[model samples]
Target: MINKVQILSVTLPGNLDAYIRIANLWPMLSIEEEKSLTQRLRYNSDLDAAKKLILSHLRFVIHISRNYSGYGLPQADLIQEGNIGLMKAVRRFNPEIGVRLVSFAVHWIKSEIHEYVLRNWRIVKVATTKSQRKLFFNLRKTKKRLGWFNEEEIKIVAKELGVSSKDVREMESRMAAQDVTFNPLPEEDFVDGKNNNTIQYLQDKTSNFACRVEKDNWEEHATNKLSNALLGLDKRSRDIIYARWLDKNQKNTLQTIANNYGISAERVRQLEKNAMKKLRIAIEA
Candidate 1:
């Protein structure tokens, strides 16, 4: 039986180089030996048998993780997630099913790596629905060149994938989109050496103190005129306007205002519209 600490020491390497060296140490098991060990682990909960199975498969996990290197995520992290899936496959593997352990474990390993890639590939998710997720991973392989797909190629891909040409176009657009930071870093600057942050461009340069004061005076004058206009209206129209628009906390609906006044909804709407027209004339005057 292998020592638990010894197995842990070799299986968990400090770096990729050490990981490759450690994986090479474990020899592949024959069908007979694998069945015997699998039976032992399955029926008796043998820790040594489980450890041997995991150690022998570390090389396979490393191989699978390499395929996902183009995603720009750390290779070591991908291998780690694949390792978790390999362990899960080992736990549920039925040796009686007449398939090799490697064949059974491949699905589990790829699933884990796919999940990791989708989660860490970008800040915003590239795929949300089932078809989008399928298109996201498979679309890259369909493209033969570095440039965008032509119309004939788009039709071919759409028919092959069982999706519309429009969907293919949309996914292609999303794939081309790159993430940009909302704010520029300290080192980032314009050609003239001024800070080029988004905040600098977002400020309203036309809103000076004089412009703000003039706008405020106009607003005050409009409020006074509107108040005088409301006073000129009958009590019912004044109450309906106040309830429908002036009250910030709880604006009443036309139906609710109609119920309050014992009138129909159409009457309430008419009254509100007339009130607005009078206010507009008063303010304009």
Candidate 2:
């Protein structure tokens, strides 16, 4: 009996509050009205019928979006994503299935909102697997207190959710961990652009990448020279150098080398010094 889009000529307000007010002001459709609109859109591709169904459901999307406010994403974004879900539900609704549009649309609405929450809730995703995702959304409600879960509580939650206690603890730890600010804020104490033991080192500058590349290149270059220098030495000298510095165990003392060579420790030390000088000269050359 009423033209739903009467305010089409009126430019919609750009603010969230005004958009929510408009959504709330939209009148709810009757059962018969909804069925007729759904049938028209489903059978004949009636654009006006689809538009009415979507407009009537915006308030429902806003209601569902409010449930995710704890996630700290923008309210407008949540509602916008939920509205997409509502549209999808409307597109797939079959009148012969004998279910209310609201009943069918709730799943679609929450699905979009859940995806939005997971994607933007944190800098790093806390839930990746099926079990972790279940923990992410339901763990908040299962939590009985304001602090970390005790051993008994963890076991209870794990049993209740059908997940391991380790998983529960891991998810809880992930939830408790706050994102670190990579760069120093303007108010941070930087002495000559340096902050000691701070997250300032986490800043991903282009220069830092270049420095790492250069360091790797120099180390590789030095390793090549050292390998060539070792080859130039006599068998005994090479064995002495390898036993002294290149041995991973670090158990080859001067006396151990001398014992194997049947020479005095002093002789071993002098040979080491002479071999190191020759290697240095060969490397620098």
- lDDT scores in order: 0.83, 0.84
Task: Give candidate 2's TM-score.
Answer: 0.63
Q: Which ten residues in a row have the lowest lDDT in candidate 1?
A: 1-10
Q: TM-score for each prediction? A: 0.64, 0.63
Cα lDDT of model 2 by residue, 1-285, tens digit = 123232222223569999989988889999999999999978887768878898898899888898888777889888888987887888888877988899999999998888888888888999988788889888976663536789998998899899999999999999888986556466765657666436645565646777889999999999999999999999999999999999898859999889998999999999999999999999999
Per-model clash counts, in order, read 0, 0
Model 2 spans > 4 angstroms off: 1-13, 144-146, 185-285
> What would the per-residue lDDT of candidate 1 be over residues 68-111, giving only the tens digit for each residue?
88778988889888987888778888889998899999999998
The pairs that clash in candidate 2 are none
